[model samples]
Target: MRHLALISGADANHTLDALFVNAPLRDYGLRPRTNDYTLPVLGMAYIATYAQRAGFNVGVLDAEALGLGIEETAQIVNGMAPRWAAMNLLAPTYEMSARIADKLNPQIALMVGGHHAKAMPDRILADPRMRHLKALVLGEGELRVAALLEDMQRRRELPGVLWRDPLIGSRAGGVADPQTSGQMLGPDIDTLPYVNRAFLPQDPYRAAPTPADRRLAASRGSDWLTAGAAHGHLEANIVGSRGCPYNCTFCGAAFSANPDVKIRVRSPRNIIGELDSLHDQYGVTAFRFVDDLFLGAKRVIDDQMAAFTQHRIGERYVWDATGRINVLDRCTDQELGTLVANGLREVALGIESGSDRILTAMDKRIDAEMTERVARRLVAHGIGVKGYFILGFPGESQEDLDATVRHIRNLWAIADQHPGDIRASVFEFRPYPGTPVWQTLIKNGYNPDELLAYGDVDLTQDGADESMRQRDEFNFSVGIQFGGVPLDVVRGTLALLTREQHERNHSGQEAAA
Candidate 1:
């Protein structure tokens, strides 16, 4: 059929990057209700649309939204009879993703991309069962993937691609020289097609965020589902920018990790235009901007907010975007107001830690003071704040843990007083190789194989544990303690922080003793 299948493989349902339903979790009486099932195409929509426009046939298989397990998903793709299947891969879900690849019809050639794939291409290709994985696309994959689809019918040299041929030997370009986004070769953000939703299931796009997200949002006057229902519309995830300028050690967005990465933003007109198309064509009124750096700087914030205001985006539709704690810390109350006035219902911050030591270790360049100032200022203006934290970092101390807990409590206190709500999205740290922290662990006699072992370990957890082992950390580290703190303290603190977030976000839960 000369068809290309763009697949978003299964991810741990517990974290923000989850694309698939957690059947294993739900089977054990865990919660993954209707709201959690459907999610917009992460980056596959762009690749699909771009390939389609380039005269290639592309099909989307969202395993998570379909609620199909590993075997069923493989069965369906085999029936589709695709010549090439390209997937976005992550470290934690490597096993699940690899399983899907293994079960695919051997006739279907595979290509992989995403940060994990970019960092660990050799490991993926070395798997004996992944023989079908012929190539790995690095960095922003829209153009690279389109080129791959065009070239896959017959092998030819292309920039930014690493492929292995059944006939020819393995090729270079995986690690050495893949260009990141916003380079001279990168596609213009404004001109790309609106991600062809026609390629994906429409119903999934119609659903709102998970229940916890909705509750926290409502606490801050940012309930997208209710607000969207008022206008007889639905919700979808959108992107305003690509790549990040920051070099936070825990993040792969650093330019050192990817070759020549640059942050790229769509023009205000282009962004507003997409909103209009989504509204009129797809019935989507509420949006969640999933940019790594949506609010780039004051100038960018002004330009986007000004354009959105001109288009009446605030009045007609609502949205939430990623924010920089350091950037917003410097923003004036009026500047924050400008963002709120332009339909920014809430801002998600990579607060990372409440302790300056941990924050400095992260290379986040923002401190607790900056975070508190930004959170307080934003909430005062009625904009929601979603603070994300990492537990058991590589070198965290007891004092650092105490500071983080205190900071989270302070954020909650701020939310309690204002119309804005705060959500502390905490995750146990897992050091992925190639990230700065991974190198630190390596210097400290840590083996990357240890993390790979976690990924390779049995994902099933005992019922005694409230949380599943197959979490986002499964790809990083399930529980090898890197920090000085003991494993018990780490888990206990994880439970404590997450439970508090649960009480605030879910509501109706009695306080824990």
Candidate 2:
């Protein structure tokens, strides 16, 4: 029997409906299917690898990618009969995680984690459905969990385990803080192991287990992983760093939300070594950095670029990363040219808003002009640009909305002129727990549960609507009237942008989910 099993279940969010609590949600298998396919659960991979290396038997089940329902997932865990089973929950996936916890074999100690879990630890432990959870991991799990398991097996004093004895009167939740936690931004990330791809289904994200499932993605235009399946383009997601340095208030990765997460960057040597390993072992040629701050700032990005150049990594491979508009705007043409020559195929930017006022409010140091300038410059350099925008933020004004609409159109125009691609991914602003906006709402008399009660919203109701056929896939809002902007206006703007993106994809350009 394995010592542990980590699972990523379907996004069966049941947090909506009831005013103050979650109601029994739909059957997991009955959840509406999407054309989208997910990447590997890297957190689970890291935790599994760390625990396994520490001499504990560990395994993983990515029910999210494998498209397994709660029942099937639990059955597999029960069959594996591991001593413990754990899951990482996002706001969207919290309900499914809880249901799976309930259905697990009583003997298997359950652990719940991820940012969502950290934001709701007491509630999770108190919830009847989650009574099976033995612990709730707070922040980064690889180091904390491994040591916790070792101490538990040896019956030693728990180094990071803050709470125990669920039956006790106090029922305090466990917190995994050690010397490293105190550093907050000082951990040597190179020490962490390369995430073992074997833990996940690889070729095409191991997403399509059967032929019919493959048909599903094809009907919606092949998923992003399918691009990797092209000759010599088999891709993998890599993270050169952990944690964001920026203060985008609406984002959960904002520093304020991650007080315990130490910001760590992998040395270029360490990163290249993993690239070589993936290339040799899994035949992966293309890479996408999933880090929140891959090209965060100038000095950091320069070091990363210098490493890629020294190794001539671009000669054979192409890669993409997240970037900041302010930093990239300040970049010299020569510096950016060097990046382009090094197979820097694309850069995903956090162009959060178009209005200068709104951008400041979001803590996105860059303004509308900077975003446009950077987008144009990148496109001219033959690098694809993916701009992410959030609308309907709390207290957002009509001028902000109009400015965003105009800004998206400007970027779309720039995209049309260059060989490089530019895609705008617009999302309605929903209150994510632990974000600055969430705290602000609470300060203004919003209930914590009310802020957490947004469920999966389906915005694509009309099948005949040719604009943005993929809008429903990316829509994560509950239509909460947090802002004065009318819901119709927000959606109307969404439709406009979605239709533009739809047309772009229809014309053979890549689309984002």
Candidate 3:
């Protein structure tokens, strides 16, 4: 059997869009187009690996990375002439996926998976508009994919498949009975082959410019930017673990669509083996670990570090990862220093809010004090820190906004001492479907239809806040804001923060001269 894996690109209607692959912020549609970075979907890559191992001809297509529109992507898939096609689906690209399915030959068995399908398989399967859809694989899809393909070959009932029941008639406008064979989660990830990156585009994918990079270039002029542009570096993305242990209300990964949410990690030896292959074959020296929470248990961290040291991983590559502040806060200075020594150049912290009260509401578990302690520790250890903050929640108030501003200022001050070491961005909260926050909003009289309709455009518009109607008129490359606080006040606060950072950078430069 021949199978194809597909990723949809931005539709013509969307101004700017980027898929993060991970659950929350699965799709980021930002304005001004600061940078172009498309990461390979490791899950899809893993699925392709399993398929090939099962003796099926497999091909991978990342429409976003290739910059191909729906028609172009369809042409490529049609040319491949595969019997089966599976797509990674997100809510923002739901309409685009449906359109692409319509364009493809109806005879081709079409299957969908990912955050959206996993969260609402019934809604996706029942929609008559998606009649061309055949099946959906829920949760972790590697084993399910292999099983589904084998079942298709033998004309057996599909296992781990979501489909419309043949028994159910057009009772409610042809909404068929949603039935699932079963849910499947893969065994040891180490047992799987390394992601087949060779199937991906050959060109080096440029990561989106960070806030620190933007501010540094603005302060230092084009000479610095020119110098930075000349560096020849290749970055690859890998996942060390699957699923998150902590539950944050706004996070789709933690609370949405994932029913059998088990956290599985690849052995350090397994991870190092992949790195060795990349370095030997592709000369890739930079990596981004896309695990939801990379720094989980102390023993896991110890084993990974030991493997890195034993295998000389630090000598070959520099890497960054996503982490929780509480985990970082618990590490000793020596532990962090060891990580820095082993090529841990940067770590991104989801310090979602500065207000402790708001943090509690979001079930972040950690308070503002924990955030400050962790930021200071990471900065002191000479590790680059990237901060992600959110502006609006269901009950966020002016006091919460003020606390967030103060926290940002504090983080900026720490960065001031070490210019170019800290990057921060504050995004307006968008209530993604399948999350606790979204469900709560629905229970509180928020219209679900309007929210889903907003989709990718929701980033640029505020569905819950009427005051934010005119906020999108301004062009602030830094971040988005959605709250009762006046737009001017928010912009003024941002400007003051930027001005302070600029002055600090100037001072540091003069001293260096």
Candidate 4:
């Protein structure tokens, strides 16, 4: 039987391989951690399970988690000697993937896929650097991969597969036409196999620790402490739904490469079955629903919650998920209360900015007041709330920064009333390709080619010669300033506001103790 090996490039050290299906891109405030938490490659696990069912031997390797450098990862792949090998690709990790591919035996059938490949297949293939990539799989890979492997055995070209053009010189060829093959979206997500966690390493994957000021964690006292201590110990990542419906300007998922932009979900029965399997087989009682919008559809949320109650799933496990403030705002108090009753412990809100002007510019639709209302409501229902804030956009000024600071103060006030009910983080806006904002940046003199050539590193850094630490400081310093706001003033204001919030939360924690 032909064996297929699936792998991720070695850790880049500046970023975490969390959010993407096949590649590592920063999403949902998940940056390269100072800690040891690594999210599992859910997409790969699904593909592995599907391949095994199709009579192919499969093996999975996470180079980063194992702390293997690119050369070392390639050596291990060479030892595996699989008939075919595929590696996930991220924009920043593209160079590392290419390096690893070069080190592999040339005869090994090598394929590449993931967010970067799907978004820029033509650019990826046309690059002289990626000449070693045999084929590119776009969008969701499970069904397409099964087809590709079958075609390989039969020695025929397959639809949905982008093969390098043999006639063109590698260095001279222009970008290939993306229409070379018809890429199809996968079948009903509900019919897909549950991720084969057994293929993963036996050691438990760690999660970033919950902040001490996190609302639900603070309110529950001992229970929260226990869960925090066990953060990533028995945690498993699950996706109840696929695709996102909203079109936030900075989101790649919202503008995913998938041809069909519709949202698809697993039935409540399917979700419960997987949860049960995780519980019984793996002793996992903690879950992180990694969906782009777990609560995007109210009916889906209601059905899933009802199923959890029916199966007593919530009684046994505690879970957290990502949601939009607008979506949660629409939920009635009763609905949210029921969710809290059913094990929803914490939620990460993509409250991108606290400034109404910035929020409007980003096309976020929701305003500052609405965000506060929803956040407080969630806390009231006993669900922990983490607010994600982004500073810096095309045109923002001191007033806008001040507005955000005011919002943070409001968040601190909420936390004071309900201690540990709030956790907030700020990130500089990154001009990721495939987003509307990226195009705006390009028009305003930012060069896409130059950025791409720099390969994938942390997005919040300068492309020139500067350490990541230096770049981070620069980003935070200038992230919120424009015409009226002096850079130092903006930085100082943000520093003061953050310090005040920190002191208040510390006081609250001390008092509670």
By lDDT, the best candidate is 2
Candidate 2 has what TM-score? 0.85
What C-alpha lDDT values do all the predictions have?
0.66, 0.68, 0.62, 0.63
Per-model RMSD to reference: 6.6, 7.6, 8.2, 7.2
Candidate 4 residue-wise lDDT, 342-458, digit = tens: 778788878877778889878887999998998888876667877777665557776787788788779767865752377775555555567666566667776666545532233
- Best-to-worst lDDT order: 2, 1, 4, 3
Task: Give a tens-digit lDDT track for model 3, residues 162-276.
Answer: 6665567221222222354323444567788877675455323544334333333444455433233244346688889887777788888873435677678888888888887
Off by over 4 Å in 4: 1-34, 153-157, 169-184, 202-233, 256-259, 453-513
- Per-residue error at 506 for model 2, in Å? 1.7
- Per-residue C-alpha lDDT of model 2 across residues 109-177, encoded as one tens digit per residue: 776667787776667767778766666667776766665565544212233232345557355533325
Going through the candidates in order, what is the number of backbone clashes in each? Answer: 2, 1, 0, 5
* lDDT, residue 326, candidate 3: 75
Task: Kindly provide the TM-score of model 3 when superposed on the true structure, using C-alpha atoms.
Answer: 0.77
- Candidate 3: Cα lDDT at 493: 50
Candidate 3, pairs of clashing residues: none
lDDT of 3: 0.62
Q: Worst ten-residue run, lDDT, model 2?
A: 15-24
